[model samples]
Target: MTTSEQLHLPAGSTGRGNYETIIDPGAREGWVHTGLRVLALAPGGSEVVTANGVEAMVVPLNGACDVAVGGEDHHLRGREDVFASATDVLYVPVGSQLTISSKDGGRFALATAVATGSHPVALIRAEDVPVEIRGGGNMTRKVRNFGTVGAFDQMDSLIACEVITPGGNWSSYPAHKHDETVDDGDHQESELEEIYYYEIQDGPSGPGFGFHQTTSSGEDKPIDVLSEVRTGDTVLVPHGWHGPCAAAPGHDMYYLNVMAGPDPVRAWNITDHPDQTWVRGTWESAGIDPRLEGEAR
Candidate 1:
């Protein structure tokens, strides 16, 4: 009998009835190979997915849709949220037979995993997303690799992306960790399984919140979460040692990282927290956060 309800999963509590929020892998107990769903349609809503063995990725957490499968017809144009900018994506393969429409509705973000192999079905637009801007002062953040691992490389075991932390920033700090598949030789990590879907921007006191942390880089994976996230929150990192994810002072943060596991390759090795790993070498002289300046793509 395991417990802790599998880390924090607030905000409307995973629309258990269906879309609007749905974490897969049966939603807990060391959640397997990643999963997520956050449909939220309305004006002329539509849905008809059947992602049998997983391998999805239709991110657009804000609006616009129309993603038929097989015979093709993808078209997303989403934006006006997730900090607006870098939208459009669609890559449904593995068991197929999907369909989605949204004449005026919004909120999408499906991002699954599990398929052993099979990568094709593409789309990825938004000026070819790939705007990395990692830490610096205030621990800057603003990554949007689109379907990660060298920015989109046709997928299999999904590993999506989306992050933007401003407003008193401090995202995923020195408290790193990737679960560990190997690399105990010096420090390299693997073994994914992560998911954090959030969005919180509304300062002047209408509604907003931020702050997420994961602990237990010991006791053989026993985790301890500290959450306060809002705007459709959902944090689940099967193993521990997460990070800052702050963004509060005025509120302006966003998340959308959905990782995978059973790693054979699809890299992304992490491993900080060894006494704070020297604070990541002071971020090359700390000096970045200007609201991520000019939004470089």
Candidate 2:
């Protein structure tokens, strides 16, 4: 993998004994403040996860698991996979430790970020997650707001969420950026470093693939990343305008987005690229792709 490819981690590239992939702030020099780790285990397998100074959420991408935090065990009724449904999640605050074990083998994601203050451990139920369909027609997609500023009000800097785009459709359209803090009355934007961990469903015949692009929002900072992503791949956005994550003709795409930064106030404010802002108006007439139902299934 090239340096850029390194940032776009493919499955199995960062595997350690029990973990399938690991990307921490320490691993990325220029990148700071956010981290992620994917753990996979066999039946009756378990791993001890601890947050030294960082706060993390135990999100089950596939299968149910038990998270033991602060001497209490919380059973997470997870889904068969990201496509199945929104799964239960557990929040682990800074300076805390936990153990996650699964009855049957499955995978879990630890979405983390640097913390400024401490918070009590919280269990977020799947039904409590606000499920919404954003955009319309082909651009339509499902969003599970489990760890956003408005969804769960307990984190310090971390903002996490998930999106599912049906095959042959686009999500995160109209390239937008949040790399700068803009605080003008009603107009507000917060600087945030983001990570996109993708999982593509199988095509009719074989494996599946998708695409993601991130380019410099302006002349000052030139960043470019266009990758053909597969299941278990990740794209990091340190700074730029990112959008139009497209799922292939027969492959649906699911991504877990983890974001955080130095911003004192945690908010997701973004400025769309001037060239792509017009796309929003078109969505009104385009009608959402029928493949995506109005509600989360």
Q: Which ten residues in a row have the lowest lDDT in candidate 2?
A: 1-10
Question: Can you give the lDDT of residue 269 in candidate 2?
Answer: 92
Candidate 1 lands at a TM-score of: 0.34
Model 1 lDDT at residue 170 = 82
Collision pairs in model 1: none
lDDT of 2 by residue, 19-83 (tens): 88788875667778888899998999999887977899989999899999898999999999999
lDDT of 1 by residue, 151-243 (tens): 886877778888889878888898888887877678678889889888889977488788888888877667777878888888888887898
Candidate 1 local Cα displacement, residue 6, angstroms: 34
In model 2, state the lDDT of residue 84: 89
* Local distance difference test, each candidate: 0.82, 0.88
Each candidate structure's count of clashing pairs: 0, 4
